[model samples]
Target: MALKQYMKTLSCPPGCNLLLDTSRFDNANSKLVDVLVNLKRIGQVSVPNTDENYAKIRQIIGNTINDPSVNKDLIIAAIMKTDAIRKRRGNSARNRSGLGDVFGGMDTGMDYGMDYEQYSKEKVTNKDFQANFTVDIEKEEKIFGDKSFGETLKDAEKLGAANNDITSIFPTAKTEEKSFEESCPKTDIHCAYVAYMENYANSLLNFKDFTQFDGKWMIARDKIAAALLHLKSSYKGKEVMQPNLDNFKNVCRKFVFLCGTKANRERSELVKSAIFIASEARADKDDLEIHLTDLFGEVKASPTISKDAAVQNRMLGADYADSVRITGSWRSLGIPSRVNGAESAIDYIREDNDVHSMHAAWHQINNQREPRDRKRERFFYFHNHMLLRIATERASNGLPAVQPMSNDVLHMEFSTEYNIRPENDPEGILDDYNSPPKTCRLTRNTQETLRNELRDLVRYKGLGMERFGHHCEQNYHADLHNLLMKDCDVGMLGYFAVSARPPIFYRIHSEINRVWHDFYSNQRYRRQDIYPPYGLTIRGITLHSRCGRVNQAETFWEKLGTHYKLNHQNFIFRIRLYNWRRLREKVIVRIFMGPQNARLENYFEMDRFVHQLDGNRLSEIRRYDKDSSFVFVKDQNDCGWPYHLMLPKGGDKRPIKYRLLVFVNDVHDQRVNVGTHPSLNNPMCGSNRQNMQNAGLELVDDRRDYGFPTNRRWTFNPVPIVNNRDRYFGYMSSIVNIVHTGEETDFCNQAYFR
Candidate 1:
């Protein structure tokens, strides 16, 4: 329930018993309250007694965030319920007044009353009041060097500096095998900025230019509300709840514009001449040029329509006035891009404007670029490959830019990584992630060894040999000979130098803290090395592995049938495992495909081995999961799941206490990459706190059913990329009960998705 307990619920490394004890309470409800407290602490929760219902609410929320598409009402309802609880709790809730005295008595319209001038004064002085403004070029250059932060940040791969490829280690077949594999960083985080902006704009827009706060806050309030509502609504209904900060910003940006109120009749009449002055008679010969000075900047009205007028308005005839006013200023304020929390607001400009022409002009010609921003404007933004590169470079080099612990996330190459660590076992010179595998001699000797590893995995693990046997010749390893000898596209990692990755699958649990989730249908990428092992999955995480090029609407199950000879029995095991994961938290189940109850005692020692690794040297260095799964995660602080490369066979303890950190020759300056906030000149640097903790706390209920975890609780570890699709179970009744507010989709479109 609490942010700390979130990982615990999932059976992740709760890390640091001391921190766990400090955060966890002994009572059942106390753990539930933990999550809410964390959301509130991070400024996401907005309920009365947030501290009380935190964990329970999060348990509900965690489910919804896991698959937001079908759970829209769940989160909103929880918010309302939390509010109700606050009302019931009276004094206890008041102490946690996140809404503050300023939002006093929001139930009735009377709450609208506020001193706009006074509020503005307050905003100016508030410690959190950082203006969304930019500085002169000289200052910007000094801080980020000559490279404009905007330019450098346009590409996601460049933003993270990931290795170009080589990371297809985890399994998720359906996601890989896509044609378009551009690694674009999510722009949805703009929702936070949108929230901030709407608050700022509301403080200004709703102003009656008077001391009375009553009427003015309505406009500001509505705009912000509309944006928030628009953004929240989408994620609430997703099958796989995704939280993209970029999309959040874009949506909010558009919604804010759309939320703008139209010009009153009085203003329209006054500016009648710039538009068509049709009282009873005709349409104008000239283009209907309405003055638009109010929206852009402060200016004096002129008696005539000066051709070169810097300040302008929408062109309108009488009938056109309403459309122009609504579609231009009012509608522009809430452009879809803005509403969806995206950058490049121009992308969502209304279709009413000749969209093609405007886009062509905006992108192709310098003339159409914003008049004032010509000196520093660019047309394009980051793509996926670039994002992958940046992220890989950062991850391999142990840089803060990209996180690697999340499953199947490192599936592709986005950049030409210039410098970084290799991902190999540190023990041997010939480790999987480091020291390139000896060039596979095309000689008969090399081919035999290659065939052997494939044979081993397939014969013992029931993978590769059978699957690829049909696709190739007797010496299947020969394929690599060509890939390695000619293309140079693939690289060596050890016994198997796989160059592809499954499509990127961000750990769903990783997004537990945020209020919104984003879901998409067509997120696929190239092959990764981990595709082979994911077949042996059951439960918590979604498993994604490679599939050949697919068509639209092709489900994972359909692809699985075509790729393998699996039947209902095997499928049942996979499905049951997935369900178990969603319901139970922090559980990692391995469905051994080979003989069940077979003697695997040698391999079975990992449970105790991991316990021995409790005080690991790597753990001592203080790194947690790299990509804080959700809610302003400070990577490696809470969600890291680092494992040793290549398990030791016939194991007792290892030959040595080896701890390896690989640096890729390709990755660029890996340590300092992070996303840039384009809206603000001075972006936030580093993170607030990682809260690195490993509570190792477990919930107690029926003992036999839980495999005797005892002190070590049975937490669920999501098998990412395993579940074919979200299917019918994503939004179970229990999840709905906690998260849904009973509000229909859009609180209006009950007829549809809700």
Candidate 2:
């Protein structure tokens, strides 16, 4: 089934789309032939007789590029199958001779007996070469200024300037701009850089490097394969799959280091551009179009802006983010504004190494009273407030107010420091230390230290404490709160302004939650008033998909560039509630999806709503209702469900079963601020359309505990109870198929999501 799905995706052999014809293989260029051979070897597709083969090869190549995790055995099997087909057809091509001929045979082990030195002399000359690729940093610096391009763009924000004022800081925006393939300029730097880097990283696609046509290419391929396998086998969603240029650079950086290949200085230049381009592309809309050349200068991608689903999917979805990030950019469209460089100031502060450490020196002694130290502290403190502020605002916006980093990641800070060797064991058998002792060592108490600072930021004596007031009361005792909040295990959350990908962020937050749970479980609710008159009841529940009602759905692993992530179709719920009161009353509704046998604590909180039903009316909330049930799931957090684990792992024999539960309580009522925006009533439960626009930043508007309503220490029993827990309401059962490979077939598309 996986193979069939994969075959269906192929329009031509992977990497053969540039060549277009198998007869193109009848050439003097051994590099081209080697590429053809490698394609058949790795992809196992027969040489094409028609355009369909080109599509198939192109798709296969794309799949391999997006998922370097393709199994070697599978490739070997495909090659063997292709070889069998060739043998059945007779070895006509294999009998060819002379330097100008096609490969002698399809044998994987054969060298095809070509004089590579002669081939290089003939093909690599200036006259023979179609173009020359080089980075002119001097020209770039002269045109754009020596300052970091990102820093220059950021000046507009600092000056409180509008979008049009960008020219004041960057005069080059007004100058004549070059085409896509031209050298980097102030206006086109991001696109040029990304193009270069993408070309460098995906050098395998073009086979442009004649010197590496044989051995190094194969080695690089194997190393990438191994790296991808390692990443996927130990799959944790911690490493982001957003196709951000930095993420791509990081992945490529890892591969380059692990494969023992020091990228040529020229190649590194291209790699840098690739990173920038990929990032900008992923952040933009899918339909946004651009024209750009791949590294080989052979494949030109010009996606048409169209609404046709078939055309769009064929052109974009194969490696959507990957393709767009490289081919689509503001520069690609001839726009000069710094749309690609406009990352939040907070993001820059967190990601820049020097800035991160300078800000991290809050606990250090030397500069305890220095003005710079104070500034650093202010910076850190400001972001701490910002994170809590966003969380607070998100809570007010009816979205999840939990620090996104709460899932499973531990953000230990590390820095490369130099130390003199002790002169013991000079052979260097003890470590992979660079030089003597300059090594990337973990900062001592990195998490704990940051956590303490964060805790201080949240406390009464911290900066901007007045905004939180007494509402900052967590149920934990002061000492335990200090202990849990200051624990060093919280990496990204501890350093709130820094880069915190959601998965690991949630992990650290979960640990903190566990600590809080320990303290909360020990406390007792002294005043338990049984107000049966205020009893809230769930009237009925139904599962929904775009097509209509459905009880089962499938979640599958979808490839996104070099990574695989589980894709889920939006499943809606139509939940009915009865106030059972004659007077209008505001109540909190909690929804959970979990195993029937699991404890309420383990139940996944899917959605929450704060509703004021009309006097004694049954309020019906739909699945797409952000105010009542929906919070847009991004590449990272899914409100409550982690995308990778959206569906339970069921075998080929059966689907995983789960129970959906709904409960209502008045405990959250006192916590709600009256006259707050009616939209903020479900605080961090539902997000606005604006929030979706800035989803890349993963920003939210809420200031609340990571686990809000459920985190409360109070308990109450409701009518029509299902779980034995003190507060229970009702539940429904459902099942789903969990597969390794499948396309998004659900009604949820960009339109529904938007």
Candidate 3:
């Protein structure tokens, strides 16, 4: 008998009427109905959705029907007499029970174990069916019975105990201790010092109410010193201890100055004591000479200060303010997320104050304890990348490129009566460069003071390349930031709030880079500076994408409004070597991109790295955009450039043409061992400072000046430079056209190669 006729003849519950609806299942597949009818005839047995029952039912369905259109849910529902047969009404909840309950709420289109599409395309064997549907007790036993699992459990317990021990060290006041525990991560080695600072900041909030004024600051200084000593004792023999301790001391002194009164001739004793404390806390001879620079403004200065350069610049001009304001609500920024291989955008800001507070916390937790050099390098890299990202975002929105702040802008004079201020300064106390409020004239004098310092630094031209790089980087960059920001509030240009959130930060760093270029432009490499023995030569270059080999690609906006999605592509560089002397050699590969007609100075750095190459007569080196050394792995603490911002938005109608340059140079530094595990392939955003230091490595161990060749002005035209037949420096340049597609693309869906 036909299945419909047979189903009509059976006198069952009204819910069973849904089984007669052919729309729900294939008409040709009557075996599923026959099996359910047999189960009903035998007596309705409730089958719970246990793993064993699910496996058994799935196996029976697979054996009976080869048709993909057969609905497995109907079979399970009929056998178990589930409530799933009841009509769904207006997104209402189902009152399903047992095996039907599990299948009722789920997406019926999806296969529980095997892929639905693959199952439809190929025949399934009994072995394959069991492998897909049944759970293996032996595999579970192997994993749970392994020795490593036991060790992992023991380590987890130890970590828990360590967390408990750390929490116990906080102040005994319940509310304060709870706040500290919530604010700080227990696993962080520097959690103790962070807790101490939290308490110190809280204590300073009530400083005015204290009756005793005598030697109060001195007592606070001693407490900080004692904390440092304790930290040293607790983490003795640890490589990261000293670096973290030094960072703690630096931040502590800054906190004191910000939270304390300004120094003056009348309070000479306080000023002298502060200086003494700063000197005593110095970790090395080259540590910041805090005394030489006036942290606080002149005596009788107001506590309140102007906004940071970012906010101040916006206030100075309506055009700049509108430029940023139009991008989106100033209160919120969209961050992208990837889950189950699908991409979605989420807004992280819940309040207006969240902007500064969230960034402050991120910087504090991620960067406050890094080694001094790594911290400084990260600062530069972060600012530079942020400037590029901002420029790219603006371009995508049909705005002009971000203009670099000219030297004259920094030299511009202001009246003493200028009265612009920020709405709030939540992170002011954490600023290491806190200064007493100053008049506009005093601010101009600070600029002149910085100029004189730079002049003096440049006058002594006898400095070697290494020393020159250090002085130019350490002394000049730090002093420029401090002097430029001295008159502003703690949150203005301080560590806590100097992120790319402000548009003016990009301008300020643009000026800094200009100065850097001026210093390093003339320091070009001689022929002997680069090794020539390897005899490397560039053959040709090819670009590949998911759609196949292509010379042009597209970058589109993500559904999440804030970011642009980069095309997934790889660069294949074919090279040939004539004289292979060693088994292998380490080489540095530098990649850069710029507008086709733009000057060399206008180019943006894509990536630079130290890589190892096997000794062969010919080879092809392939690199992916996602694996660029410039990016950090997507994680909570990542501060590296977003991989999405790798390419700027191209023209809407005609594609924008860009020149891609790749430079290969030999590594001379013997301390660098590139072949070690966790190799230097992605070393730009370092893994961990402690781990790297323990291995006797810096964040970037390459002794060469960062952004070499391009750092200096070797030529006006890059074509000739790449076309040169220099054996020591082999370079290749290619043209890439970027098209702007005004649509959203899922970042995870892009084609990626291993």
Instruction: Estimate TM-scores for all models.
Output: 0.15, 0.34, 0.47
Worst window of 10 by summed lDDT in candidate 3 = 338-347
lDDT tens digits, residue span 330-388, model 1: 11322222112211121211111121122211211121111222111111110111222
Model 1, C-alpha of 507: deviation from truth (Å): 19
Q: Is candidate 1 or candidate 2 better by lDDT?
A: 2
Tens-digit lDDT track of model 3 for 278-345: 33333331233332112322211111212342354367563322223222222121221111111111
Among all windows of 10 consecutive residues in model 1, the one with the lowest summed lDDT is 731-740
Output the better candidate (1/3) by TM-score: 3
Candidate RMSDs in Å, in order, are 31.6, 27.0, 24.3
Ranking by TM-score: 3, 2, 1
> Candidate 3: misplaced stretches above 4 Å?
1-407, 411-443, 464-491, 527-534, 559-584, 634-637, 669-687, 693-700, 715-718, 723-731, 745-754
Best by lDDT: 3
CA error at residue 53 for candidate 1, angstroms: 69
Best by TM-score: 3
lDDT per residue as tens, model 2, 61-145: 3344223343221232233233323334443232323111211111223222222233244311222221111112222232223
Which ten residues in a row are the worst by lDDT in model 2?
A: 293-302
